[model samples]
Target: MMRGEGQELLNDVGCICEENGALDLLQVVVGKGDVYDGIWTELQKDHASLQAEIGYLLQNQQKFDVNLNVRHFGKVTKSTIQADGTLMDAAEKIFRGTIDFVRGSADSVGAETEQVLLLGDDVVNKTIPVILCAEENVQGSHGAAIGELDEETLFYFGARGMDRTQAENTIARAKLEAKIQKIGDADIEQKVKTQLAEVLDRDNR
Candidate 1:
């Protein structure tokens, strides 16, 4: 977890997977802040694998940049998920992800996905997902989706008597809530929800 307020926050992570080992990592960031995050993973033996997930919510003039690098030295698997949301003008984000399948990593599989939601026109979002293969039997894939709120969805909220700003806030909260819900700790989830409500209310003011 990280927070930024008119300043830059940087994070670097490294992981090594031994024979028959598996690693799972999750990173989450929130608020109107600037952030840079980088993660590197290396698979050292057969059957070693890694999974990583990152989530970000940026509002106001916040900015975030993320990089993920994975190298498969043996038969292994790598999977990554990145989700980001931007709610106001001047917010920007960039994501760069790469997976390398080496010669001995035959039969290895790598997959990556990135999703970004935008709520204002003045916000900027960019994503670059890459997979490099040095083995013929390896498989790699990546996908990305970026968009803003659709009119029909907003209209449905409007019919329920919620204004545009209210509806947008709801959507933004939902995006971050989805990530928090994955924590697998009921007590922690409730605590985070309480903090989130305070943050959201402050932002509205």
Candidate 2:
């Protein structure tokens, strides 16, 4: 219905839109270069009743990428990818509502998004490889964090019993475990657990 920002919109590649509703965007960011590389396949039958809302908060240096695919019948297909890579090449997405046919992956198919966050003199690097897809009858949502400890959360943990290092380790391990459980893949889950344990042990050393 209404599109703003006068931003250069890419096509048939990184992120594409083929829908009927107005893409109400507010200060979205995207990476530069040949970022688009796929033809999104969406069904066109259930139109008129599609809605989406997106919000992104990012901080980084490298490039960021996003791809979306949405379909509806008897109406039009809609796909959107909005982001702000202001601080860093941060990747984010928000999907709320239903779909007739769903396909494709967001969070970079075969690329790795790495970021290094610094606190005082301590430096830690984080790399996140995310591939998310969902089939919803009504509504669905997805989110990710591919970085080190949060200052506030770490402070809370330290205030309780852990030192800075111990708190970071504990929080990192817990985050990994939660991510593994969300995936629900046993093999990968065990691998993540082992890696988290190693990281935690190293923190003590």
Residues 1-205, candidate 1, lDDT per residue (tens digit)? 5453667788999988888888787766775468888888898788888878777667667778888898988875555555555446567888888989988998788888877878778888888888888899988988888887899999999999998878877987888888888888898778767766655674553
- List clash counts for every candidate, in order: 0, 16
Cα lDDT of all candidates, in order?
A: 0.77, 0.34
Cα displacement (Å) at residue 63, model 2: 8.1
What are the per-residue Cα lDDT tens digits for candidate 2 across 58-95? Answer: 22222223344444333333333322111222322222
Which residue ranges in model 2 land beyond 4 Å of their true spot? 1-66, 71-152, 198-205
lDDT of 1: 0.77
Q: After aligning candidate 1 to the native by TM-score, how far in Å is the CA of 199 from where it should be?
A: 3.9
| TM-score of candidate 1 to 2 decimals | 0.90
Q: Point to the candidate with the largest lDDT.
A: 1
